[model samples]
Target: MSEINKVKVFRVQGTGPTPVTVKISRIGKALRIKCDCPAGAYMDPCEHWKSLFTGEDQNYLDITDDEIREIQDWLDDSDLDEALQNLLYFEGHEKNMHENLARQKRALRGRVIDILISDPQL
Candidate 1:
């Protein structure tokens, strides 16, 4: 059996008032897994979502199992960011890679702003 066919299950903590537990199970020939999140059922798994299943941090929202499988398929077939972008769209969110990058750049600029604001002569 291929690695994709192997069954993998993960328990993730939720961020709600009551921490939620998520379970992911790998399904077929593709490196797809099934998730127990409400959104997980409709969307593919993302690295963040996969992290949830792999005992990583709980930064991802709940998703469905089939969606996890689809994500796995995309990951296997495409680049990481491409797969992620596709997965993001599946979750009703648009991937703003450029925007995020710009935000990071702006944050870096803040250091310059601080230096300028703190006048040495003042």
Candidate 2:
């Protein structure tokens, strides 16, 4: 069978005393990215994974630049790429989505959580 199921865990700096776990899983067609921090465990996307995917390296205080670049490159090649791109696009152009703002936000959150809670190939 074609290889598609995969998971990558990153020890991200910031958000707490120790590094946090940021997991990116590709199960079937969904890309479920999760963070173990308080906010993330509740299905909210914390700045830990958000900053990593959003390329906000300067916001980091503990990780090295090389580590940041590695995560960036890895995410760029992973299934999360499309999701990240979609998120970036949505954030940048959502002003045009005027009336659909709340609905879109809810849809994105539910879709992401649903993907994460589903059975995993791993």
Candidate 3:
């Protein structure tokens, strides 16, 4: 069978923290499922995938193409936000160069500290 490369988006509703977005793509007979939750962050198959592929339950609703576009737009906007943040961190005028660099360094250090504090592996 020919593989359809188009991705299908779905929202899984459950009694968990919040609804999770799942994207599935089919290549041949194999299905690649991805989710936005922490479990999916490491590219692990999530509950959303189990339900769809394991035939346990169909807990997800297929989302429209417009909804997918909106999600993509939001992700693009987040990239823009990160770019703006980097500009504030590293591209300031020379007059406040030291201060700006220091501030950015502090922000990064804080992130490291936070991760270390919360991460089980640390």
Candidate 2 lDDT over 1-116, as tens digits, reads 67456666767667468777777666665567787888887988677777766666534545567766655665645666786788778875875777578889988999888888
Span of 10 residues, lowest total lDDT, candidate 1: 23-32
RMSD of 3: 17.1
| Quality of model 2 by C-alpha lDDT | 0.70
Sort the candidates on lDDT, descending order: 2, 3, 1
Using alpha carbons, what is the TM-score of model 2? 0.50
Task: Output candidate 2 Cα RMSD.
Answer: 17.1
TM-score of every candidate: 0.36, 0.50, 0.42
Q: What is the TM-score of candidate 3?
A: 0.42
lDDT of 3: 0.60
- Give the residue spans of candidate 2 off by over 4 A: 58-86, 90-122
Best by lDDT: 2
Residue pairs with clashing backbones, model 2: none
Listing every candidate in turn, what is its Cα RMSD in Å to the true structure after a full C-alpha superposition? 8.8, 17.1, 17.1
Residue-pair clashes per candidate:
11, 0, 0
Q: What is the lDDT, from 0 to 100, of the residue 108 in candidate 3?
A: 100
Better of 2 and 3 by lDDT: 2
Alpha carbon lDDT of residue 50, candidate 3?
50
Candidate 1 residues lying further than 4 Å off, grouped into runs, are 1-4, 17-29, 44-48, 52-56, 59-122
Residue ranges of candidate 3 with Cα displaced over 4 Å: 1-3, 27-31, 63-122
